[model samples]
Target chain A: MHNAHNAKSILHKISRAFLILIAFTATFTAMILSPMLSVNVNAYTEKKVYDYGDLLTDREESRIEEQLRKASENCGHDIIVYTVKSLGGNSVSEYSQRAADGINTDSDGSGILYLVSINDREYDIYAFGEMYERIMSDRELNRLADDLRSYLSEGDYYGAFSEFGKRVEKAALNNEDYSGNISVRLTLSFSTLIVSAFIALIIVFCMKQGMKTTRPEITAGNYVKNGSFKVTVSRDVYLYTSVSRVRIQSNNNGHRSGGGHHSGGRSSGGHHSGGHRSGGHSRGRF
Target chain B: MTTSFKCACCGADLRYSPGSGSLKCEYCGTEFEAEAVEAMAEAAESDAAGENINWQHANPQTMENDGSTCTYSCSSCGAQITGDRTLAASFCPYCGNTVVMSDRLEGMLRPDYIIPFKVEKDAAVAKFKEFCKGKPLLPSGFLSSGRIDSVEGLYVPYWLFDAGVKGRVRFRAERVHTRREGDYNVTRTQHFMLYREGVMDFEHVPVDGTSKLGAEVTEAVEPFDMHGAAPFAKAYLSGFLADRYDVPQETCRPRADERIRQSITSALANTCRGYTGVRPQQQFISVANGKIAYALLPMWLMTVNYNGKSYTFAMNGQTGKFVGELPISWAKFWGFFAGITAALTVILTLLMNYFG
Candidate 1:
């Protein structure tokens, strides 16, 4: 009576073990690959410097200009010139110590600029237009411009930005930093990473909370019907609902099996916003 | 003379299907009328029905304390039967067998249906063995086959109540408004009715009939296959011991009713959407058709004595689903606790450095 070959149970155990193993391996792979990916990104960036792209709104651009004027007036840099370029694709926000002049219209004696700010940071800038384009790649030009503005902010405008421009001029003289001048592409890549990370985290958190299960209630008749679960953006901000049924019937004979079935549906609705707009809604029922 | 009935077409045994309302043959697909079988089986029931006497007077055995120090009393014999929190009562302790005593069952609300045991005793044992095999904290000697005493067939008391439940709730929802001052938008609420029909089915829910065990203890031994339960039969009690519930039948009705009400009301709140806050103003649930029964089911019971503690295990006799107490190996427990703490601490420290 002790013979033990139960195919169903054996299969169930094996499947569960396989699932757990897969889960652990996937988690481990993600952790190990993250740092490697970051390193690869940093290396690629060092070889080919880029721009911040055209993700910033017109309002953001103006905000950066306003901040720069306040910094120049209050910080006593005596800002001789202020030129904030839309850059179309290569927007800079932060600055360091370097080029104080010979940027964005030196002919008019109004080229020594200070800052170009955005949603994330402020960048130092210098622009030498068509006259310098033959010598500088767009990528190098953006970097030089940012560094020049940064140099002025740190009060070392002559050393950093001046040295950067000198290096560009040398590269032009020798002809080397021109082939990899993808300033526009680099800006797009950086912007894409930031936006994607934000969106992914929001979606993950929503799905996790939405499907969370609660403890079931046990009844007097030995029946354990599942309890209610809520899907919400926040507590009481219900997005969807679902219900399940547990049925028990009388056993006419001592040789029958008694079990229940599960079936249900859910619906969810929420707001999706793009640009500077809000109040558009989408609802899904399934 | 013994008379046997088989399908005329395939010579297969026929079974009655409720949904079909007829006796269908497993082989070659034949159907038979229950009315015809009823007349033929009448003689068989007369003899077997002898055991279906008054439940109160049946299985009257005397109070004999089991040798085990921690026994709960047997419902039939009034015999002292020892059990711990983890031990599901299956058999009378003194009898050393799996038999359901008359006292531990409902008087008439017993299950009329059950799913027969598909997994045998050995398979159930194997399942338990696999569960314990690689658990680092489990002791090697704990699962030696010699320690397993026996399995019991018992009919536990349960309540099956049905009712329609409804509730009204009021809530607040918020929306935002923007003004062109410096920049950003301001938010506000637009309240609305989040009403829904949240209906769910109620089944063989277990409300413990006896107060001998706490509610928590019973809950821990979850997930019985009521689907495999058989009709009430003292013959099923032949190989096992059973207990009569000490608590009165009426005493357990209110508790079962309470669980139904809670599930229904909570379901209502769950359906509503886009509300800031919702409070249950009015709620109602009525237990319609209050019926009860007594039946004998199956369980495999085991007890182990370790370091001055008695641990128990119960396996569903019909389905081979197992539940039991774990003998905590203090050394392994400490090791697991320390390892988890250290790993989590390291991860937290790394996160702090990266984000800080």
Candidate 2:
């Protein structure tokens, strides 16, 4: 009877050890698989390319998406490219705004979106947040659109999107914007210091010259007798006439209002009912 | 020969008093009218002539001139004073007594008119201080280091010219008209050939007559009011240094003509108005009825030494107009420049950030 009882106790201890091994294996497998699952989710969510129009192949879309992702990382702003088959009942501007509003990534909403509508043959660029206030203006958006219009007209959609990515990246890196409305990073560069020093030297030189009060008198104005000047024969004869004409320059460049439809009803941080986002856009037929 | 004026009361040396028109004794404080002093000297000369006494023997200070230089004995201290032929009056360095070289002022060298000093030495020193007051860049030690004893009264000779100028001036002038026509700016310029002829007279244009003084230095203190001028007398030379005309009259004629030409040309140019631009094409000026006279003008001169350099200052004795070049302090200049530059840089940066 004692031998039988010891055999039962050993058997119970073996089963408990087997169950613990099973639980450890299951928890370790879950820990490894969960990260892969989250990575897949983040990869989809972080995608900057939304090609619903079937303009690019899967491979081309992936390549452009990777390019835009790197560029966004570099410029600290999300850059997006969205293509749609139809705008439904909305204008290109509203469609683009909806596309921007649908972005659910974890980035701060300081970004720009390039939208293309295949059926409507229209394209638009929308900016929000810091990117809007710093570098995006109506003129700059139009300039970017004009630069990519040729590729779009040629039906090289892949090339157009790729060039768009490159140009946006370059512009973001340079922080270039429309003239007369852009903030400049103030720096006391060597050239600025040199020019300032030169100007200062000239001012001080003039001040030093003022110390010299003596100069040779070349005119005798003080010695001229008053009331003694006379002009006996004064004649003004017409000799010839010459005429010149110059065309006046038009000063209307870069002051044009955007041709795109604008809605002051989207917040920079999130979509709202009627609050206007501080941003700008440009739209045109491709 | 040097002649030192003596006080009639105490026999002490008499010096010419500014704005008083008289000689005042340094010891007795007695003043004698300049005209009365001249009358007494003339009466003495006549009495010596009546007695048939040699004037040089009676006045032992008189001596013969040796070519371009003259030596005279000071009546007050008996020190021998030597100077160039142009030196009409000077002070004896050892005795600090004034001596007038009477022989140098004889004959053709005599000045026709003299403007007596109206600004005294003390007033001139005050004017110097005033002149240096407003200058910010002047060296800090310049005014403090300047000595008052270096200031001296001087009678500078000048050649006064009166001339009637007849001139003809031709100018190429233009009248420009600008009009806007349909996105174009149309400019029409009317060219004209202008001729102006004039006759004018200039009175009493004084030119510096001493070669020792530069034209710039002498011309700076100008227009000694001829109204204050009196007939030149030897009494005016007492206690003051005088310079005879070292620059010849012929040598100064070109300067007078140049000045007259400039005046006439400017006068003719003034008549041409209502033109956008006028440039002189040709000018022909002829000076007529030119008259020249010699005069002695008063100037207060001082030399200040600073930083091992001497700077000369001069004041118009009649008008008290002082002129001099002041030294610049580099420390102050650089500090001001840096401050202005920093201020402007900050302002420009703020403006760019706000507007750009």
Top lDDT: which candidate number? 2
- What lDDT would each prediction earn against the true structure? 0.39, 0.67
Stretches of model 1 off by over 4 angstroms after superposition: A1-286, B1-119, B139-146, B162-185, B190-203, B212-230, B274-282, B337-356
Question: Residue B45 CA error for candidate 2 (Å)?
Answer: 61
**Where does candidate 2 chain A have its weakest 10-residue lDDT segment?**
A178-187
- lDDT per residue for candidate 1 within B246-333, as digits (tens), equals 5554665566556655655566665655444655533444333444443334455554554445555555565565655556454434
TM-score of 2: 0.54
lDDT value, residue B220 of candidate 1: 43
Residue-wise C-alpha lDDT for candidate 1, range A177-258, written one tens digit per residue:
2224334334433444345445544543443332211123453334534552222222232221212233344456786564
- What is the fnat score of candidate 2? 0.62
True lDDT of residue B296, candidate 2: 81
